[model samples]
Target: MIVISSGSNHANAQTSMNTWAGATAQRVAYSTSRLQNRPDSAVTRDVRSALWRTPNLDASGIRVRARLGTVTLTGWVPERRQISLAGHAARSVRGVRSVSNQLLSRNSR
Candidate 1:
């Protein structure tokens, strides 16, 4: 018996592996593999590119680094909202296992 859990009691119900739901689950697993195996260099470039693309956030002073798929954002922003925006931008990039937002608001200066 094969069971796929989707956060409900019925998730324990057995289903044929040939079902459409099974196919969807397989696709999700494949995508997860891609996320786990991304190179740190690629992840860093993607995060930096995303930061540059995000509007309303002046990422000029921001520095992005990636290690083992975990991205760290550091430096300063003009406002508190920009800090959150910068973190969001980093998190949105593919292959980012996690984000450590260390950006400081100008108020702290």
Candidate 2:
């Protein structure tokens, strides 16, 4: 009969497990960054459309920046109401966690 002992083989198994864990951590980090950056692209398009149709907003000058799940709306609109409206519209989009209203009045332009 042949028996396997736990010294060398156990060491090798532990090392392999550590290596796999390190690789998994690296992959998770990469995936997280990709997910963070993805919102920037997706929200830009939605912001454009929502701003265009919002009666209170001046869509032409509006810009949106997204990081992680946060959105910031910038540039000028004709009315104060537009600023609130812009933030509301951004918040309504899927994956938006928060919004910063940086919209300025048209007179400020």
- State the TM-score for model 2: 0.58
Model 2 per-residue lDDT at 46 = 75
Model 2 misplaced regions, further than 4 Å? 1-38
In order, candidate lDDTs are 0.84, 0.77
TM of each candidate vs. truth: 0.66, 0.58
After TM-score superposition, what is the CA distance of residue 55 in candidate 1 from its true location, in Å?
A: 0.8
RMSD of each: 10.5, 6.8
lDDT of 1 by residue, 14-69 (tens): 44434767799999999988656578899899898898899998888899889987
Off by over 4 Å in 1: 1-35, 107-109
